[model samples]
Every structure is written in C-alpha cells, then in structure tokens.
Target: MLNFSNNKLNNEGRLRTVLDIGCGVASFGAYLLSSDIIAMSLAPNDVHQNQIQFALERGIPAYVGVLGTKRLPYPSRSFELAHCSRCRIDWLQRDGILLLELDRLLRPGGYFAYSSPEAYAQDEEDLRIWKQMSDLVGRMCWRIAAKRNQTVIWQKPLTNDCYMEREPGVQPPLCRSDDDPDAVWGVSMQACITLYSDYDQGVKGSGLTSWPARLTSPPPRLADFGYSNEMFQKDTELWRRRVESYWDLLSPKIESDTLRNLMDMKANLGSFGAALRRKDVWVMNVVPEDGPNTLKVIYDRGLIGTVHNWCESFSTYPRTYDLLHAWTVFSDIEKKGCSGEDLLLEIDRILRPRGFVIIRDKQAVIDFVKRYLVALHWETVATADSSIESDHDGDDIVLIIQKKLWLTSGSLKDTE
Candidate 1:
C-alpha cells in the first residue's frame, strides 16, 4: 500500500483519478468513491458478458473499451493511476505495446498497480514473464514503488531524465516529435514513449491543486488554451445559474433518487459538471474531438471525461446513462456534415428508458429535433428560453424531454 492518510490519498488529493483496466464488476471503483477518488472502469465486450453493464447498474462510472490496436478514447496523462488486478492481459505482447499505452495514459510520476500471477508466481513461465515485464518498464523509466503479496506497484518518472539517460537504439523508442499525445480519437496505439512537455519536465507532478480546491481554482493548463482566470470564473458562474434553472425544471418532474448516471454530451471547459458537485450524480463529461482539447482541463479539476466524436457512437452499452445534457451538440455535429437525426438515434440508444434530456440550442435546431420525438418515444417535459439577459437573439431555447418507458413485443411476455 502507499500509506495513504485517513483524510486524503497521495499529494493531498492530486491523485484522484484512476483507470481500472479489466475491472470485474468495478468493485475497485465502487470502493474508491467513498475516498473521493473516481476510477474509469474499462473492459471489453468479450467473454465477460456484462461486467461493464453491472458496473453501470450499480451507479459506477464505466465504459466498454480495451487496450487494443486503437487508442482508448481518452486524452494523454488523464489518470494518476492505472490498475490491473488479475485482468489477464498479456503485458509483454507485441514488444510491450500494451504497457506503453498505460504509459501514455498516466501522468508524470503516476502509478500502475499490477496484481497478477507474474508478480508472485514462481513457475518457469511466470518467472520469464515477470523478468520481461520488469525490463520493459525499466526501459520506460518506471521504478518499483512497492511490491507486496501479489501486487507490484510501479511509478513513472516525474521528468525526462531517465528517458534521456537510456541507451541508444532501445527497442521501444521515443515517439516522434510531431506526435500529438492528446490526439486519441480513432488513433492507433503506438509502441513508443510519450515524453513530457517542457513545462511538465520541470514540475514535480502535474501542477494541480487538491480536490475541492482544484474543482474551483483555475487549473494550470488553462494557459495552454489561452484561457484566463476571469473567463473560468465567469463560465463557472454562468453554469451555476443554468444548473439552478435546470433543477427547477427537473425537481418537480421526478423524485430525488431518480437520477444517478448522467452525461454532458458537449462539455465545454467542464463547467456544467463542476457546478453539479453538490448533487448525488456522476457526470461523464464529453469533449468533442474537433473542439479544443479541454479534456485535460476537466481531469485537472478532479472530474472524469473522454474525447469523443458525436458522429460516431459512444463507447458504452445501451441504456447506460440516466440523463443526457446536450448544449448545442446537435448543432456542432451538424456543422461537420453529420446528420442530426442519426445523433438523436445514438442519444436514444444510450439514454435509459424514462431518462431525461436537456437540449439547449437555437430555435431552428430545436425545431428540427422536435419533429423526431414521437418516433423516438420521447415526450416533451418543458421548454423555455435562455436565462441570459444578453441573449437578445430571442432564438435560444432550452428543451427538456423524457424518454418514455415503453417495451417492445419481444419483452411483452415477461411478467412477474
């Protein structure tokens, strides 16, 4: 163990995000919630029929994904820890490419906790694997932080010193200078180390504050996007008012316990989810692939999200979210030569039956989506104008709708 304190984990809660690879039923993530840590539990839809499904059912954040040929739909350096416990992944396959993927996901000085037979088993095969994995991570500039029982924790270096000191012509070489670490959508996993930036190389860890403070304070990465603290504060205040108005519309329509899993389809700077911290819901903040790379900003704030393209389906099972928030997502995709109707269908597939959707966009877009409500089995709950007084355009609208709890003929025979 890392000898964490009673009140906080390492680095005064800077170590908040976790990537639990092959999380069976997400029990690890479930236990982490009590400690103010949020883990993005990932598993592929394979022999494990419904592991991610069960995790979502229990209100834990999860996604159906794997470290395969394609990159995981997340920006680089998003998690403080990457964990795999008896997950049955071949770390040494394809020249340790799978382990390199973890290296890309982890932040500077991040930790990877491996609990597998190779760590404790003494058989010949296990020993060979353990030796290879050890050498692979050693070349990748990772050191054993702790090893006990069946677990061996490795910590990534905080600077590029170890990498620069490596011998020439290493098997797994450094990524090309032109490679973008944050470019993950539809990208392939490369078998190379992603070096830290000039700023990150100087810092000890991610220049982030503690959890609650990090939530409100302007993150250090804001400067990377040329965003000012004033802008962050103004955005935060705007979302505060908008969320209050949203609760006013939703409070009367459903009970308090109705919503647990939520998704912000077009999260900008993640202010919307930040404003909802007091609620008992966990929001999957999504930043479009075409937009600014603010997913790192979202992570620095102690929140979780992924980089996605609305043109494609989200990486999750059907009926995974209890509520979906769309702030001009349909319009943004429309501008990209994508169909709004198809986006609506994808939304319907992910939203749970009887779930709620709040769409805020111009009047023309709202009218276009309204035409499909009947065919989609959704009913309008409320519609209102934007609360901002400066919106003199008089076309901005907020349309709230609820997905009907209807069943098809296939399930009609099911009766208790």
Candidate 2:
C-alpha cells in the first residue's frame, strides 16, 4: 500500500484529509480516521452496508454511491489525497472520466494512489491498461511520484497550464477548453456503461473527501526583496502579450539560426521556457527551492525542457548555454533570500562567450542590475523600456547583456 506520510501530505505542518474509494471492509478508512486523518469512504450501497457500518462505528465518514453514474457529493478541490485498491472501478474508462473526477476533487499538489498488487502482469491486456493510464495522466499533467510493481502514486500539478487552452477564436486551438465539464467526464451515460463493462470484464476497480490544502490566510510579503506573491499571481494575458512582444523583438537580434541551449532562471512552471522553445533549441527551467512544487509541475507537463533548482549552480560546464533568460529572477532571488551575485556569476560561468542574458523588471531593478553586474565583468549590450506600466510599480525595463571573452594561453578568459 502507498504511505501518505511518505508523500508528506502534512509537510506544511497542517492536518490533511483523504478519500478511500472502494474501501473494502472500511478497514483502511477506519485506520486513517483513528490516526487523526479525516478519511471518507465510498462503496456501493447494496454490497457494502456492513463495511460502511463498521466505518461509521469507527467515526470514519462512509457513503454508498456508484461512480460515473452518480456524481461524487463533494465540492471541487476538496481533498488532499484519494486512494483506491482492489476495487471494481475502471479508472481509465471513457478516456479517464473517473480520473478526471478525482482531479476535480483533489486540491492542487494533492495526491492519488491506486494499488493493485495482484493486477501486475506482463500480459498484453494488463500492459495496455497501464500504458493508457500513464498516457492519460501525462496529458492531464499529473506527476508520477512512484510507480512500484503494484501501485502508482501521482501528485496534482501546482498550477494549471496557462496556454494549454488558448483564448477562444484565437487562431489554431492550443488545447481543448479545460473549463468544459463535458471534456472531463464525457457523456455520462456512456461513461457509466463503460464502467460496468470494465467491471464485468474484470478490469474494474473502486470511491471519498477532505479539507482544503492551502493556508487559511496570506503569508507576509518579502518587504525587502523586491518580490511579491501578488505580482507573480497576476500573470494576465496583458502580461503575457508584453513578454511575447519583447521576445519577438529580441529573436531577430540573436545571431544563432538555431539557438542550441537556453536557461530560464527562476522559471516558475516554465511558461517562459514553453514560450521560447523552438525546433532545435533545448531549454532548461531553473526554479527556486521553495517555488511551491514548481519542478514537479513542469516535469509532469512533459514540456520541452529540463528542470533544475536555482539554489545550485548550473550543472553544465562553463560556456555551455547559448542564451540565458531570467524575466524576473533578480527580484525573485531577493525574495528567496539568495545573493544576486551568486546567480549572476553562475550565469556568466555557464554561458558561452558573447552569449546573451535577458531580464525584465522595474526601473529600480534595472538600475541595480547595471550597477552590480558592471562591477562583475559583464558588458551591458542594450537597455530599453518595455512600456508596460503597473499601477503599484514603476514601468518595466528590458535589460540585455552579453558575456565578454578574451583569448589567453589557448583558452577563453573573462575580461573587462
């Protein structure tokens, strides 16, 4: 069985909740409830009355309901975890309508554990189901925390993909409408039929609720670090358009026909990396250590980029990347309690000679960049106003710099 503690459901030092689907005998639910975890269990009314009674006797919430046919009686984003084992529910049926329901119930960064020790087989049928489950979750952007012989644990993404579904009437559709209920559950009747068919064919499984996984109130802002959670949270289309326009203008000025390697510093969920990816280039996303589970979210999306932490220097050797893009990294570093000098030196050390560094932030940040970086042997190439002004902050400035190279003793050296 999967361990909830290992998954760190209470990592933030708070109480957590879970749902136990197809909870046979209600033993698991009872145990979780006894352990101070709020556990809810769902089993069919006709078949599991005694088990439900046992769960209720133990103070575990128990209910009778058929998935697919009956909507789960819980508000969306209600659970920190959902678990199923040896039940007769087809999670992969109807292109994963059941899984989508779980997704709906799970808060962001929540977990789902499906256990079937006896179901493990090299048979084509079993393999087919496993592959389908993996692919479906992959598309849903759920992170596979573990894939043992009899179980698979997945963590829900921290944030929904921004451009997964583009604005309606905007050229080609980037993704199907995420908000459309039909897209998640499909035709309810057919889904029900499919669930029954799987159960009859011995390919079916099992159903639960929880507390909210977020803090009850906002934490204090980093007043000194030039960063605010509010700004990062307000990434509207207007902000995207401005960033896109900046990149479009910068692309032509870059000399490389096929920019080989790029790094995005403090790349929260990799929207910038996704935006900048091309046919030939490899983009790497580096996020802060406490970026609210950013690395896993990016990995789960299977975007065209590698994920790393900003606390460490780039693993690549000196002169490795063709370009480095850090839209708001300096400010993020300030907020994250890291030295800007360390980040800049690492960027310079990893970037190839004359490789570009691009950043965008407020004018105060731009001035700080000019002052600090010039002292560290960096050459300022260009600085321009992004013309995007915020009501509470100054107008954004786009600063571009290049690493300088001097040949000495048959090797490249950094020089003024």
Count of backbone clashes, every candidate in sequence: 0, 8
Question: What's each prediction's TM-score?
Answer: 0.95, 0.40
User: For residues 24-117, could you state the per-residue lDDT of candidate 1 as single tens digits?
Assistant: 9999999889878889998865787378999999999998886689888778888999999999898899999999999999999999999998
Off by over 4 Å in 2: 1-240, 256-258, 277-279, 304-309, 372-377, 388-394, 409-416
RMSD of 1: 2.0
Query: What range of 10 consecutive residues in model 2 has the weakest lDDT sum?
Result: 191-200
Instruction: Name the lDDT of candidate 1.
Output: 0.89
Clashing pairs in 2: 21-207, 22-207, 87-205, 88-204, 88-205, 89-204, 89-205, 89-206
Best-fitting candidate, scored by lDDT: 1
lDDT (10s digit) by residue, model 2, range 303-394: 22223445566434356676788877778768778887787788878777867888877777778778866566677777777554332234
